[model samples]
Target: MLPPIYTWLKASNAVKAIIGNTPRAYRPGDAPQDVTQPYVTWALVAGVPDNQLSSTPPSDRYTVQVDCWHTTDKGVEDLAKAVRNAIEPNAHLTAIPVNNRDPETKLYRIALQFDVLQTR
Candidate 1:
Protein backbone atom coordinates (compact mmCIF):
# COMPACT_ATOMS: atom_id res chain seq x y z
CA MET A 1 0.00 0.00 0.00
CA LEU A 2 1.05 3.56 -0.60
CA PRO A 3 2.38 5.39 2.43
CA PRO A 4 -0.47 7.55 3.73
CA ILE A 5 1.47 10.68 4.68
CA TYR A 6 0.59 12.60 1.53
CA THR A 7 -3.02 11.65 1.58
CA TRP A 8 -3.53 12.35 5.28
CA LEU A 9 -1.82 15.73 5.23
CA LYS A 10 -3.59 16.86 2.09
CA ALA A 11 -6.93 15.91 3.56
CA SER A 12 -6.53 18.40 6.37
CA ASN A 13 -8.18 21.77 5.87
CA ALA A 14 -5.72 23.28 8.33
CA VAL A 15 -2.75 22.23 6.24
CA LYS A 16 -4.40 23.55 3.11
CA ALA A 17 -4.88 26.93 4.76
CA ILE A 18 -1.20 27.21 5.58
CA ILE A 19 0.21 25.87 2.33
CA GLY A 20 -2.56 26.78 -0.11
CA ASN A 21 -4.07 24.38 -2.61
CA THR A 22 -2.94 21.20 -4.23
CA PRO A 23 0.79 20.76 -4.93
CA ARG A 24 1.85 22.68 -1.83
CA ALA A 25 2.68 19.40 -0.10
CA TYR A 26 5.22 17.40 -2.08
CA ARG A 27 7.54 14.43 -2.07
CA PRO A 28 11.28 15.05 -2.10
CA GLY A 29 12.61 16.00 -5.59
CA ASP A 30 9.09 16.71 -6.84
CA ALA A 31 8.63 20.28 -5.63
CA PRO A 32 9.27 22.99 -8.20
CA GLN A 33 12.45 25.02 -8.06
CA ASP A 34 10.52 28.23 -7.51
CA VAL A 35 8.04 26.77 -5.06
CA THR A 36 7.02 29.16 -2.32
CA GLN A 37 8.11 28.91 1.26
CA PRO A 38 5.77 27.96 4.18
CA TYR A 39 5.29 24.64 2.42
CA VAL A 40 5.79 21.02 3.38
CA THR A 41 7.61 17.99 2.02
CA TRP A 42 7.54 14.43 3.25
CA ALA A 43 9.13 11.09 2.52
CA LEU A 44 8.87 7.52 3.75
CA VAL A 45 12.29 6.93 5.24
CA ALA A 46 11.91 3.36 6.48
CA GLY A 47 9.50 0.48 6.87
CA VAL A 48 9.09 -3.05 8.19
CA PRO A 49 6.37 -5.63 8.12
CA ASP A 50 4.80 -6.71 11.40
CA ASN A 51 5.96 -10.28 11.56
CA GLN A 52 3.55 -12.91 12.87
CA LEU A 53 4.37 -16.40 13.92
CA SER A 54 1.79 -18.32 11.95
CA SER A 55 0.12 -16.06 9.43
CA THR A 56 0.85 -13.31 6.95
CA PRO A 57 1.69 -9.99 8.48
CA PRO A 58 -1.40 -7.92 9.08
CA SER A 59 0.25 -4.55 9.06
CA ASP A 60 3.36 -2.62 8.19
CA ARG A 61 5.14 0.06 10.17
CA TYR A 62 6.57 3.09 8.40
CA THR A 63 8.70 5.94 9.49
CA VAL A 64 8.03 9.15 7.61
CA GLN A 65 9.93 12.38 7.76
CA VAL A 66 8.04 15.64 7.36
CA ASP A 67 9.72 18.96 6.84
CA CYS A 68 8.08 22.36 7.13
CA TRP A 69 9.79 25.39 5.65
CA HIS A 70 9.33 29.12 5.62
CA THR A 71 11.33 32.30 5.37
CA THR A 72 10.37 33.42 8.87
CA ASP A 73 10.85 31.44 12.07
CA LYS A 74 7.29 32.04 13.26
CA GLY A 75 5.86 30.97 9.94
CA VAL A 76 7.79 27.72 9.94
CA GLU A 77 6.80 27.01 13.53
CA ASP A 78 3.15 27.60 12.76
CA LEU A 79 3.34 25.28 9.80
CA ALA A 80 5.00 22.64 11.93
CA LYS A 81 2.28 22.89 14.55
CA ALA A 82 -0.41 22.63 11.97
CA VAL A 83 1.22 19.53 10.55
CA ARG A 84 1.52 17.90 13.95
CA ASN A 85 -2.10 18.66 14.81
CA ALA A 86 -3.20 17.23 11.51
CA ILE A 87 -1.38 13.93 11.72
CA GLU A 88 -0.47 13.25 15.34
CA PRO A 89 -3.68 11.44 16.17
CA ASN A 90 -3.17 8.82 13.52
CA ALA A 91 0.56 8.35 13.91
CA HIS A 92 3.08 8.53 16.70
CA LEU A 93 5.51 11.42 16.42
CA THR A 94 8.84 9.69 16.87
CA ALA A 95 11.08 12.71 16.95
CA ILE A 96 11.89 16.17 15.73
CA PRO A 97 15.03 15.40 13.80
CA VAL A 98 15.70 18.92 12.54
CA ASN A 99 14.94 22.40 13.70
CA ASN A 100 17.29 24.87 12.08
CA ARG A 101 17.82 27.61 9.60
CA ASP A 102 19.61 26.76 6.40
CA PRO A 103 22.75 28.84 6.17
CA GLU A 104 22.72 29.36 2.42
CA THR A 105 19.00 29.85 1.92
CA LYS A 106 18.23 31.42 5.30
CA LEU A 107 15.03 29.44 5.41
CA TYR A 108 13.67 28.10 8.67
CA ARG A 109 12.98 24.38 8.69
CA ILE A 110 11.38 22.09 11.24
CA ALA A 111 11.68 18.43 10.45
CA LEU A 112 9.47 15.89 12.22
CA GLN A 113 9.38 12.13 12.07
CA PHE A 114 6.33 9.95 12.60
CA ASP A 115 5.90 6.23 13.09
CA VAL A 116 2.77 5.00 11.34
CA LEU A 117 1.28 1.55 11.42
CA GLN A 118 -0.73 0.68 8.33
CA THR A 119 -2.79 -2.40 7.77
CA ARG A 120 -1.60 -4.52 4.89
Candidate 2:
Protein backbone atom coordinates (compact mmCIF):
# COMPACT_ATOMS: atom_id res chain seq x y z
CA MET A 1 0.00 0.00 0.00
CA LEU A 2 1.17 3.54 -0.73
CA PRO A 3 1.21 6.43 1.71
CA PRO A 4 -0.93 9.42 0.80
CA ILE A 5 1.44 12.27 1.76
CA TYR A 6 3.25 12.38 -1.60
CA THR A 7 0.07 12.50 -3.63
CA TRP A 8 -1.55 14.91 -1.22
CA LEU A 9 1.34 17.39 -1.39
CA LYS A 10 1.59 17.11 -5.13
CA ALA A 11 -2.10 17.83 -5.57
CA SER A 12 -2.42 20.56 -2.93
CA ASN A 13 -3.42 23.87 -4.42
CA ALA A 14 -2.37 25.66 -1.28
CA VAL A 15 1.12 24.26 -1.41
CA LYS A 16 1.37 24.90 -5.10
CA ALA A 17 0.41 28.51 -4.72
CA ILE A 18 2.94 29.10 -2.00
CA ILE A 19 5.82 27.34 -3.72
CA GLY A 20 5.45 29.44 -6.85
CA ASN A 21 8.09 28.54 -9.45
CA THR A 22 9.90 26.12 -7.17
CA PRO A 23 10.04 22.51 -8.24
CA ARG A 24 8.04 19.77 -6.63
CA ALA A 25 8.99 19.33 -2.98
CA TYR A 26 11.34 16.44 -2.62
CA ARG A 27 12.76 13.97 -0.15
CA PRO A 28 15.93 14.98 1.74
CA GLY A 29 18.42 12.86 -0.18
CA ASP A 30 16.91 13.72 -3.54
CA ALA A 31 16.94 17.49 -3.33
CA PRO A 32 18.77 19.08 -6.26
CA GLN A 33 21.24 21.98 -6.16
CA ASP A 34 18.68 24.39 -7.54
CA VAL A 35 16.32 23.52 -4.71
CA THR A 36 16.76 26.75 -2.89
CA GLN A 37 15.04 29.95 -1.78
CA PRO A 38 11.47 29.75 -0.56
CA TYR A 39 11.25 26.03 -1.16
CA VAL A 40 10.08 22.95 0.71
CA THR A 41 11.64 19.57 1.35
CA TRP A 42 10.45 16.62 3.35
CA ALA A 43 11.14 13.06 4.28
CA LEU A 44 9.34 10.21 5.89
CA VAL A 45 11.41 10.05 9.02
CA ALA A 46 10.17 6.69 10.17
CA GLY A 47 7.38 4.20 9.68
CA VAL A 48 6.02 1.06 11.25
CA PRO A 49 3.25 -1.31 10.33
CA ASP A 50 0.71 -2.59 12.80
CA ASN A 51 -2.41 -4.74 13.27
CA GLN A 52 -1.40 -7.87 11.51
CA LEU A 53 -4.00 -10.61 11.85
CA SER A 54 -2.87 -14.14 11.08
CA SER A 55 -0.10 -12.85 8.81
CA THR A 56 -2.31 -10.38 7.01
CA PRO A 57 -0.92 -7.13 5.64
CA PRO A 58 -0.27 -4.73 8.47
CA SER A 59 -1.51 -1.19 8.80
CA ASP A 60 1.11 1.56 8.71
CA ARG A 61 1.93 4.57 10.83
CA TYR A 62 4.51 7.05 9.61
CA THR A 63 6.20 10.15 10.91
CA VAL A 64 6.90 12.66 8.16
CA GLN A 65 8.93 15.81 8.62
CA VAL A 66 8.61 18.81 6.32
CA ASP A 67 10.93 21.80 6.16
CA CYS A 68 10.09 25.18 4.71
CA TRP A 69 13.10 27.33 4.03
CA HIS A 70 13.77 30.80 2.72
CA THR A 71 16.38 33.53 2.93
CA THR A 72 14.03 35.57 5.13
CA ASP A 73 11.49 34.55 7.68
CA LYS A 74 8.54 36.02 5.81
CA GLY A 75 8.53 33.46 3.04
CA VAL A 76 9.31 30.67 5.45
CA GLU A 77 6.42 31.62 7.70
CA ASP A 78 4.03 31.96 4.79
CA LEU A 79 4.98 28.62 3.37
CA ALA A 80 4.83 26.97 6.76
CA LYS A 81 1.37 28.28 7.48
CA ALA A 82 0.22 27.20 4.05
CA VAL A 83 1.57 23.70 4.59
CA ARG A 84 -0.04 23.47 8.03
CA ASN A 85 -3.39 24.64 6.77
CA ALA A 86 -3.27 22.22 3.87
CA ILE A 87 -2.27 19.21 5.94
CA GLU A 88 -4.55 20.01 8.83
CA PRO A 89 -7.55 19.93 6.53
CA ASN A 90 -7.08 16.21 6.37
CA ALA A 91 -8.62 14.93 9.58
CA HIS A 92 -6.27 11.99 9.76
CA LEU A 93 -3.09 13.99 10.29
CA THR A 94 -1.97 15.80 13.39
CA ALA A 95 0.45 18.56 12.40
CA ILE A 96 2.94 20.31 14.64
CA PRO A 97 4.94 23.23 13.28
CA VAL A 98 7.98 24.77 14.88
CA ASN A 99 10.31 27.53 13.71
CA ASN A 100 14.06 28.06 13.95
CA ARG A 101 16.95 29.51 11.99
CA ASP A 102 19.59 27.30 10.53
CA PRO A 103 22.89 28.14 12.19
CA GLU A 104 25.04 27.31 9.21
CA THR A 105 23.06 28.61 6.24
CA LYS A 106 21.38 31.35 8.26
CA LEU A 107 18.14 30.55 6.58
CA TYR A 108 14.87 30.74 8.45
CA ARG A 109 12.84 27.59 8.44
CA ILE A 110 9.71 26.09 9.84
CA ALA A 111 9.96 22.47 10.70
CA LEU A 112 6.81 20.44 10.97
CA GLN A 113 5.73 16.86 11.20
CA PHE A 114 2.67 14.83 10.38
CA ASP A 115 1.56 11.74 12.17
CA VAL A 116 -0.07 9.56 9.55
CA LEU A 117 -1.86 6.27 9.92
CA GLN A 118 -2.74 4.03 7.04
CA THR A 119 -4.83 0.93 7.36
CA ARG A 120 -5.59 -1.46 4.56
Candidate 3:
Protein backbone atom coordinates (compact mmCIF):
# COMPACT_ATOMS: atom_id res chain seq x y z
CA MET A 1 0.00 0.00 0.00
CA LEU A 2 1.10 3.56 -0.56
CA PRO A 3 2.45 5.37 2.48
CA PRO A 4 0.36 7.93 4.26
CA ILE A 5 0.65 11.43 2.77
CA TYR A 6 1.86 12.96 6.02
CA THR A 7 4.47 10.24 6.37
CA TRP A 8 5.75 10.92 2.90
CA LEU A 9 6.14 14.62 3.62
CA LYS A 10 7.74 14.03 7.00
CA ALA A 11 10.14 11.49 5.57
CA SER A 12 12.34 14.27 4.21
CA ASN A 13 14.03 16.47 6.80
CA ALA A 14 14.21 19.32 4.30
CA VAL A 15 10.49 19.03 3.61
CA LYS A 16 9.72 19.08 7.31
CA ALA A 17 11.68 22.28 7.73
CA ILE A 18 9.94 23.98 4.80
CA ILE A 19 6.63 23.03 6.33
CA GLY A 20 6.79 23.67 10.05
CA ASN A 21 5.27 21.43 12.72
CA THR A 22 1.57 22.10 12.50
CA PRO A 23 -1.55 20.47 11.11
CA ARG A 24 -2.55 21.96 7.76
CA ALA A 25 -5.99 23.44 7.22
CA TYR A 26 -8.20 21.95 4.49
CA ARG A 27 -10.53 24.81 3.95
CA PRO A 28 -10.38 27.31 1.11
CA GLY A 29 -9.15 30.57 2.61
CA ASP A 30 -6.77 33.50 2.31
CA ALA A 31 -3.98 31.84 4.31
CA PRO A 32 -2.84 28.26 4.60
CA GLN A 33 -4.03 26.71 7.84
CA ASP A 34 -0.61 25.38 8.82
CA VAL A 35 2.90 25.13 7.50
CA THR A 36 2.79 21.36 7.12
CA GLN A 37 -0.42 21.47 5.12
CA PRO A 38 0.07 20.74 1.46
CA TYR A 39 -2.50 21.58 -1.15
CA VAL A 40 -0.51 18.97 -3.04
CA THR A 41 -2.00 15.82 -4.53
CA TRP A 42 1.41 14.27 -5.13
CA ALA A 43 5.17 14.95 -4.97
CA LEU A 44 8.32 13.12 -5.91
CA VAL A 45 12.07 13.32 -6.58
CA ALA A 46 14.01 12.05 -9.56
CA GLY A 47 17.43 12.08 -11.23
CA VAL A 48 18.58 13.10 -14.69
CA PRO A 49 21.74 12.84 -16.77
CA ASP A 50 24.50 15.45 -16.47
CA ASN A 51 25.64 16.00 -20.05
CA GLN A 52 27.97 18.85 -19.09
CA LEU A 53 30.20 16.54 -17.06
CA SER A 54 32.03 15.01 -19.99
CA SER A 55 34.72 13.62 -17.72
CA THR A 56 32.20 11.88 -15.47
CA PRO A 57 29.72 9.86 -17.43
CA PRO A 58 28.11 8.44 -14.29
CA SER A 59 27.15 11.85 -12.91
CA ASP A 60 23.40 12.58 -12.65
CA ARG A 61 21.23 15.57 -11.78
CA TYR A 62 18.37 15.64 -9.27
CA THR A 63 14.83 16.80 -9.99
CA VAL A 64 11.56 17.32 -8.11
CA GLN A 65 7.87 17.31 -9.09
CA VAL A 66 4.88 18.72 -7.22
CA ASP A 67 1.13 18.53 -8.00
CA CYS A 68 -1.05 20.79 -5.91
CA TRP A 69 -4.20 22.90 -5.70
CA HIS A 70 -3.91 26.64 -5.25
CA THR A 71 -6.41 29.32 -4.36
CA THR A 72 -4.46 32.12 -5.97
CA ASP A 73 -1.71 32.61 -8.55
CA LYS A 74 0.48 34.58 -6.15
CA GLY A 75 1.07 31.51 -3.97
CA VAL A 76 1.96 29.33 -6.96
CA GLU A 77 5.30 31.06 -7.54
CA ASP A 78 6.29 30.90 -3.89
CA LEU A 79 5.15 27.30 -3.61
CA ALA A 80 7.51 26.32 -6.42
CA LYS A 81 10.40 28.05 -4.67
CA ALA A 82 9.54 26.30 -1.43
CA VAL A 83 9.48 22.93 -3.21
CA ARG A 84 12.89 23.56 -4.82
CA ASN A 85 14.42 24.52 -1.49
CA ALA A 86 12.94 21.41 0.08
CA ILE A 87 14.31 19.02 -2.53
CA GLU A 88 17.43 20.68 -3.93
CA PRO A 89 19.05 23.12 -1.56
CA ASN A 90 22.46 23.20 -3.22
CA ALA A 91 21.35 22.91 -6.83
CA HIS A 92 19.64 25.56 -8.93
CA LEU A 93 16.02 24.48 -9.49
CA THR A 94 13.42 25.82 -11.89
CA ALA A 95 9.65 25.22 -11.82
CA ILE A 96 7.44 24.97 -14.90
CA PRO A 97 3.68 24.64 -14.95
CA VAL A 98 2.93 21.47 -16.82
CA ASN A 99 -0.81 21.69 -16.04
CA ASN A 100 -2.69 24.69 -14.82
CA ARG A 101 -6.42 24.92 -13.97
CA ASP A 102 -6.49 28.30 -12.29
CA PRO A 103 -10.14 29.31 -12.42
CA GLU A 104 -11.76 25.88 -12.44
CA THR A 105 -10.34 23.87 -9.55
CA LYS A 106 -7.65 26.35 -8.75
CA LEU A 107 -5.17 23.52 -9.09
CA TYR A 108 -1.65 24.46 -10.15
CA ARG A 109 0.52 21.47 -10.90
CA ILE A 110 4.19 22.07 -11.63
CA ALA A 111 7.20 20.06 -12.61
CA LEU A 112 10.56 21.39 -11.35
CA GLN A 113 13.74 20.21 -13.01
CA PHE A 114 17.29 20.86 -11.81
CA ASP A 115 20.83 19.56 -11.76
CA VAL A 116 22.54 18.23 -8.61
CA LEU A 117 25.96 16.93 -9.56
CA GLN A 118 26.60 13.52 -8.08
CA THR A 119 29.89 12.87 -6.28
CA ARG A 120 31.78 9.83 -5.20
Query: What TM-score would every model get versus the actual structure?
Result: 0.93, 0.79, 0.43
Comparison by lDDT, 2 against 3, better one: 2
TM-score of 1: 0.93
* lDDT winner: 1
For model 1, residues 26-97, the per-residue Cα lDDT tens digits are 888988898887789899999999999999999999999999999999999989998998899889999999
Error of 1 at 28 (Å): 1.6
On the 0 to 100 scale, the lDDT of residue 18 in model 1 is 87
- Top candidate (TM-score): 1
Model 2 segments beyond 4 Å from truth?
21-23, 91-98
Over 1-120, each residue of candidate 2 has an lDDT whose tens digit, in order, gives 545655666567777887763445777777677665667788787888885668865578888888888788888888877777766655244555658899987889888888777787
Ranking 1 against 2 by lDDT, winner = 1
Candidate 2 overall Cα lDDT vs. reference?
0.72
What local distance difference test score does each model get? Answer: 0.88, 0.72, 0.47
Clashing pairs in 3: none
**Which 10 residues in a row give candidate 1 its minimum summed lDDT?**
1-10
